[model samples]
Target: MTAELKLALIHSPTEPAQEAAKVLRDRYEWVPIEQATMAVALGGDGFLLQTLHGMLDRRRILPVFGMNLGTVGFLMNEWSPDLLENRIERAKTFTVTPLRMEIVTVDGESVSYPAINEVSLLRETRQTAKLEVLVNDRVVMPELVCDGVLVSTPAGSTAYNLSAQGPILPLDSALIALTPISPFRPRRWRGAILPERTRIMFRVLDPVKRPVSAVADQREVRDVATVAVAIDRASSLTLLFDPEHALDDRITMEQFAV
Candidate 1:
């Protein structure tokens, strides 16, 4: 099976990743990314996200197997140069859909980006950002005064959302977390979890005075007036992990971490 599959090697520019890539290249034959059915990524979670984003941008999705060579390899498997083919052959597959974020800037410019992790709206200055939260065009929270807020998919709930005290969602929960950074008003409002199909819209109040910026994973847009986020089910990506250390198991174990 391994011999029949065309594999592409993608690695971060870091020295460790570069060195690992050299060893892997010498041991295995790799085809160009455009011609490969599967990809092997070397680096940490950040690098894996970059590789996934690249595939999404090019509209050429491929199942990716990532090895940890950087810090906090939450999205990567244990690095083992030997038995790579065997590991991939026995790997478990996980499918995750990204969020599509549409932003209308203060200048009336429209832009769109995809976020595999989460979409965040942050205050640009010392002043707290005031936002109106709307779910499916219906007003929920008329005003949310906070340092920032984020919408996270289950695949990303353990990331920034977890840091913001968001609930941990199971891989098949079909739920998304709406977490607040630091709320001044509505002091008791921690956050909420909505269905995956929910459309979340945040309208920045007083955009000129208390400007807010929107970020979709790594991409950022400054001075956003309104931002909309929803799951892009059609653009789902596949990740392959070792059966013993699958992503769902890791996420479940995070809840037990002290």
Candidate 2:
């Protein structure tokens, strides 16, 4: 009996990805993207994000293996065709829950989406975004004068959250990072680590004076007057990595190296 393995390949529009696709076609039986148990994503972090979002939009969950074909390969593995089966069989699985963002637009429009990494509320104009932040229905910060604020999952903390000076959380740790970007008021406050189950609410103090936009991964909502974020652990996404290069070790190494 032949070993029946269905594989799906997703690639970025990069030179390396085109070359890698040829190699994949030569080695395995390619299946439709929707019918595969495993997906090989060929791209840098950005493309990986795109693939994840695409899967989520389709309401499908599958383990994804990423190869570096873009600028940053932090979430990707070293691309090699030699040990593909061995790597897949020995891959470690980690489950990550995305944050759900609900935003109410200034025109009374309501939109909601899920974010694999974080949900950010950013100032739309040159003026700073003044917001009132609430956690678990209680006001935590009455007035947050800043360029933006973001709540990131542990898997997403390394992305935009890191650039905003947020802490690097271990993948297994059940916590959320609330980081303020370029804050003007509340000068001493950097950020906070909240329980994974907490719900965060951000209300723009003055929509006309301080216009804000909310983004859930690649999905964007312009002119948002209020936004709420919460981790949806019930529905999760899984990522597969070679056992030796598990996500935990990578996150640990990232801390001490830089």
Candidate 3:
């Protein structure tokens, strides 16, 4: 086994990425983005999310090395030209599973997708949306009048979930955060930390009066009547990081930072 060190480069179509691509092409034996054991991603957190979405599979583990080229490179490496191959060879690994969202429209149309960050349901119209939330087929909150509701993975606990006054969960913890965007009826309903295996269901109170939209990461479906969410532990994804700067440690440190 010749170590199977095939490298792929995925970059945002930016000036910096173009320059970096040229450098990698000139120096290394790189393959197409679709056929590489390790993928070097260029851009910020958004691009990283897109990359994860593009290459999400359980059996095929593609270690990704991201060099920051966009703003807020929380999931990226510091941009540097030196010791590139060395850094990749010595990189660490982090395994993450995305949440699966099954959304049904008012007309009985159904669509399912995976969410690496979070699955959110928001009001599509001007009227505040009313939702009935359930966990594992049990009615937890009968009437959750709010602008929106979200279920976030531990890896995504820091994104939209945190800004909505949700708790920051540790990455290794097998927990999911069920957070409300802006609750009106349940004013004191803070949030819930459910088991990763639990299935969550959200039913729209009135699709005609309060139209709602459900989003599984970047994929959005409007006029949603009901949405179900679950963690896809069977089909998870893996991400590689610097051993010293592991993603879990970074997320843990983000909370205590001044």
Candidate 4:
């Protein structure tokens, strides 16, 4: 009912996605993002994240149904050209709250960015980054001398976190994964799992020498100082998935993937 009434078709810059968009638009009369009840996105995980961010940028929170057309389709569903509307009508929604990264640069300018995946702190140069970990304003690690670190949501634990040898979390779990990038001094520290609402903070021990940057998904803030990260519980995005291939199911299956 609502899926057929008002829907928008958005795609990435890839040739396949553009071609798919043309075919979808030709078959279905979809409206713009501003006037749509739901949006059907084409492309891979990166484009899907972009689409979600675009919606948040406009302060619109419509449901997004993503079709895979990229290398890694971790956050996308299988592409079906037939009965797109019918599939959307039967789709299940999963609400994902992004991590809010508050970054203050060397100039003391504070800015906030929302990450749908994970917020990673990376070394800018050849020098190893010295980072101090804080949880709820309490010091956890006095100094971590290594590449960098990150805080990942259950929705993102399978992405970069898994690649970094971090634990994979179930989608519905009310927890976050704190994983280290590469540790030299503290080789035994395997990171921690905190509650979803915990305020995890990272302070650069010698920011001037180390020069670590924080990335909130793809949005990057360069240079200096403290980075505070936490889930933005006030805001969330609903992603639509086919019943048989839901996000939670995928997350569970990923743990078993060899």
lDDT of each: 0.95, 0.89, 0.86, 0.89
lDDT of 4 by residue, 1-258 (tens): 354569888999999999988888778888878888888999999999999888777788889999999987888988867898889888999999999999988779898989988999999999999998999999989999888898999889998988888889887888899999898769888889999989999998888888999999899998859999999987798999999989999899897899
Question: Which is the leading candidate under lDDT?
Answer: 1
Q: Is candidate 2 or candidate 4 better by lDDT?
A: 4
Candidate 1 vs candidate 2: the TM-score winner is 1
| TM-score of candidate 2 to 2 decimals | 0.96
Using all chains and alpha carbons, the TM-scores for the candidates as numbered come to 0.98, 0.96, 0.94, 0.97
Q: Model 3 scores what on Cα lDDT?
A: 0.86
Candidate 3 matches the true fold with a TM-score of: 0.94
Q: Model 1, clash count? A: 0
Candidate ordering by TM-score (highest first): 1, 4, 2, 3
Candidate 3 lowest-lDDT run of ten: 54-63
* Candidate 3 local lDDT, 1-258, one digit each (tens): 125888887899889887887887777778876678788888888888888887763345577888889987877778776777888877787778899999889999989889999999999978999999999999999999999999999989988898998988898899999999898888988879999999999999999999999998899999999999999886677677778778888889889866
Provide the RMSD of all predictions against the true structure, rounded to 1 decimal.
0.9, 1.4, 1.9, 1.3
What number of backbone clashes does candidate 3 have, counting pairs of residues 3 or more apart or in separate chains? 0
lDDT of 2: 0.89
Clashes in each model (backbone N, CA, C under 3 Å)? 0, 0, 0, 0
How would you order the candidates by lDDT, starting with the best? Answer: 1, 4, 2, 3
